[model samples]
Target: MRPTVTPCEDFNAEEDAKALKKAFKGFGTDEDAVIEIITKRSNEQRREIATVYKTMYGKDLVKDLRSELRGHFEDVIVALMLEPVEFQAKELHRAVSGLGTDELSIVEILGVHDNDEVVAISNAYEGLYQTSLESDIKGDTSGTLKRLLVGLSTGRRDESCDVNEEAAVKDAQALLQAGELLFAGTEESVFNSVLCQRARCQLRLIFDAYNNLVGHPIEKAIKNEFSGTVKDALLQLIECVRDRTSYLATRLHDSMAGIGTDDRTLIRIVVSRSEKDLEDIKEVYYEKYGKSLAERIADEEEVPSDVKKVLMQLLL
Candidate 1:
């Protein structure tokens, strides 16, 4: 189900004027209360609060937030105020612009987002940031990372298109020639042009054929052939077509059970994937570790305790 999109009147201009005044009236800023309301409010609420804050105080909520709170708390609050796509674009921009690209951030966003989100993020990045995300990425990154991000940002994340058998055969041949082809246009292009291009049922047969020819799972082949951002994008495309829940479960497992739990990765996967398959992930999580996914997350220390708690609530 889509998240509730209702406008929250309680957090709008008039109400927020009262709330913000109250928040700032007592003492050296009630930081916890600031988090409590902002984090709990719906996105519409946050946007409304931003408008209210500016009109009421003649200062931006983000600016006020920066002055009031410090560290990741501020990041999360500001992120909440921006529209979701714009927020994601900002995150993408941040991932690439600083000292070095955060490949993990790239992977989490690319892998978990739906195709429409990927396209929207691309458009939003260019329009809002006044620069092409792809160009920025190219300047910042190198090697396979560059290739993969460029391919994904080219706006072909969805595999739900038409399939031509003759084209599929030809593409399949090309993949074979490339020797463990991983690039989206190379192996993935062929698959989409063929298998995923076909009707869903027919696509299964095509996938079977692909496995027979490759002597490995197509998904596994892509995994082995790609790494970092590109590997993530290809895997997400395949998972979108094949099995969403299993794919998410695998990602969640990789995040927590590895050498270390990547807090950002863990948070992104749980927050984004929860809407699609929380119950299924819970089942898989239990089956895989003989424990609830929530329990595993709770035990992990890297991710913020509050974020873990929020994820647990979302899971439940």
Candidate 2:
């Protein structure tokens, strides 16, 4: 079944502020209630609250929290109150601007997201900070990694304009021919034509044909044929067709179940997906790895326990 788009719930920021201020005033701290409502609220509601809180309380909601709370507890609370794109842009900007590139953070964030969201993040980053995210990536990263990040940031890497069965057939044929000849030129042409030019449904069918003829997943073939941005884009298309949740669940399990945890991937996945489908991901994680998502996360001690506990709560 296809996922249905529902309109976001309407929330009055001023109304919520009155309630929140009252709740905060009465108790020592309504930490439990704060977590409950904030985590459950839609991104639209969070944005509304951010504006309303400022007008109602004369302080940024996030700033107020920094003064009121500390540690992992504070991080999750503040995170729940920001717009998703702004949050993502902040994460991306943080990932690269430091001494070393947070390549894993960049990969996990951009890799799991659909192209449209990526473009929104790009636009939001510029609007919020008056700096081009693409330029920051160019300045901060180098080599194949730089190419991959910039290509992703451009938001065109996954735009499929129109579906032509005739075109898909031709593109699939070209891919077969390229694999037959071991010609690098034909490989790129095949990728561009099928992955870039074809519509989503058309490309899905094209990939089916490609796999039937080659007896291997297109992902494996592209991994062998391409490098850098080209490779990332092709693999992204394959994963997009495959179940995204399972792909991410598998990623999370692998990142943590390894010799050492991939803290960035683990944190970003939990932070971003909890509201959308963390429960579904938990089920997928269990089925794929024969262990619950929570268990794997619990096993990874390198991350602070408070952080891990809050992550688990968000999914619940």
Which candidate has the highest lDDT of all?
A: 2
Q: Report lDDT per candidate.
A: 0.63, 0.68
Candidate 2: lDDT of 94?
83
Candidate 1, residue 126: lDDT: 93
For candidate 1, lDDT tens digit of each residue in 66-142? 77755444555566567778877877887887686786566556545656787899899999889988899889887
Q: What is the model-wide C-alpha lDDT for candidate 2?
A: 0.68
RMSD of 2: 4.4
Candidate 1: which stretches are off by over 4 Å? 2-13, 28-32, 114-116, 157-170, 180-206, 219-241, 258-261, 270-289, 306-316
Total clashes for model 1: 1
Give one digit per residue, the lDDT tens place, for model 2 in 167-187.
656767788777555645444
